[model samples]
Target: MSRPDRTHFAPLLRVIHWTMALLVLAMLFIGVGMVSTTGPAYVSLLALHRPLGIAILLLALVRLAIRLGTGAPPLPDDLPKPQKLAAKGSHGLLYAAMIGMPLIGWAMLSAADDRVSLSPSLALPAIMPHDLMLYWWLRQAHTVIGVAFFLLILLHLAAALMHGLIRRDGVWQSMTFGKIPGKRD
Candidate 1:
């Protein structure tokens, strides 16, 4: 049977969205910890960072597929053209970073001849040949991209707040839980 049209995202998509949100936030902090220490704690942080990055990469692929197949709800009609363009551009950048970050990290490690070890018995094969120069370059690019990704996230949060609070538009509710303020189920 055909289901009723959804004003919000599909349940599965919402679940993945929130789950990835937490994971990504944890990753950012873990990344900072990994870079800031060189002691016993660094070992623990690296252990967490590698596996978590792979998980994010895999989940991002699944999320992108679901998004493409199901599509998102339209933006509010009153949203300005510039804001609409920004929304589209930002989402594209978000997905790009979600998918690209891990790949770059893996390649960076690969160029350094390091294994992407997920566990004592499991590890991913290197995708790039050992080249210290290349590894150094990728490492710098990764840090720059990571900072840009974080800034993009902040902008995204501000936009969401604008929609949910100042604008009182349904755009924010489209991806959120519960019934929209005035809309019936």
Candidate 2:
């Protein structure tokens, strides 16, 4: 038998989820775009990209705080223990990646002596001393971690689709549509 969708998510949670989704997707694409170019052409793009990444990092921090403070909707009674555990683990990994990726990116830029400014010609203080080896390592770290994040996203999407398709649940609804009331067991 099929199950029902619960108006599970709070409005704020939905907003945070989608906002982060858009920003993260942009970051993923821009990370690729940055490495794909050479010369001074995409230097400006990297400039924009770095600051925007930082902005996303800040926002992620805020979202993380809110998530910790508020309770998320619990899984339906029908969910098995292993599936529930997987859901919890996937979310934890997602949050860690969300926080870690941009931060490592920031550290990556900081290691390269890239002090970004909001506008052209303005300057900010560099956080770390510029070392070629450190910059190279951090760049590689950022690339590897970004790819991991992409993989995690695939798993996340698969689980969400599973809730909608196989489980006949509204896991997406909570985050997608406004909260649907949880079904009484």
Candidate 3:
């Protein structure tokens, strides 16, 4: 009923954060499932994967817009410059990966243009022609970019834990409970 505490994230931001987090995790699963399986299994999972990838692409764009318009809270004054730099680098990579992965996938599909059947009844059209060259290239790019994104996720988690448990700061609070610290004093 009331606004989120200043030290905390607004409800909208929290929804975006958690929703994005879950979507990213699902994307990872869909990706892994697609590769680990073949034939009918891969095809079925991929049907879900393709549409979801498109949706995530849209969501990421919206999230970025919101993030730009609403500046993130400032870092604790005591956080060292180097750590701050690392934080920035990691977050930037997260954003880049979010945008890059979907673009590459769409490009590859567009180039393939083959009727890649996600299921027996539902065939998802490829975005491109079936050029072996383009397919291989985008596939490689996707893999490499995905790895980078994976590592960034780990670093993001580590940073959150560090702030929540060790630093005892309100950084985690902002994202989780939707509040910041030091305001009560």
Tell me the tens digit of each residue's lDDT in model 2 across 1-185: 11133245556767878888888888788778877889574776687777777778788888888776665766777889998888888888888888888777767677887766656776556666788798899889889889989988988988888877677665666677633435442
Q: Candidate 2, overall lDDT?
A: 0.76
Alpha-carbon shift of residue 92 in model 1 (angstroms): 0.4
Alpha-carbon lDDT of model 1? 0.88
Question: Which sections of candidate 2 miss by over 4 Å?
Answer: 1-7, 39-41, 121-124, 178-185
Clash counts per candidate, in order, are: 0, 4, 15
- Which lDDT values do the candidates have, in the order given? 0.88, 0.76, 0.76
Candidate 1 lDDT over residue span 1-185, tens digit each: 11236577777878898899889888988888789977898899999999999999999999998887777877777888999899999999999999999999999999999999999999999999999999999999899999898899889989998989988777788777866777776
Give the Cα-based TM-score of candidate 3 against the true structure: 0.84
lDDT of 3 by residue, 45-74 (tens): 777877777778888898888777665766
- Model 2 clash pairs are 6-180, 7-179, 7-180, 7-181
Task: Give the C-alpha miss distance for residue 34 in model 1, angstroms.
Answer: 1.6
Best by TM-score: 1
Most accurate candidate by lDDT: 1
Superposed Cα RMSD, model 1: 2.8
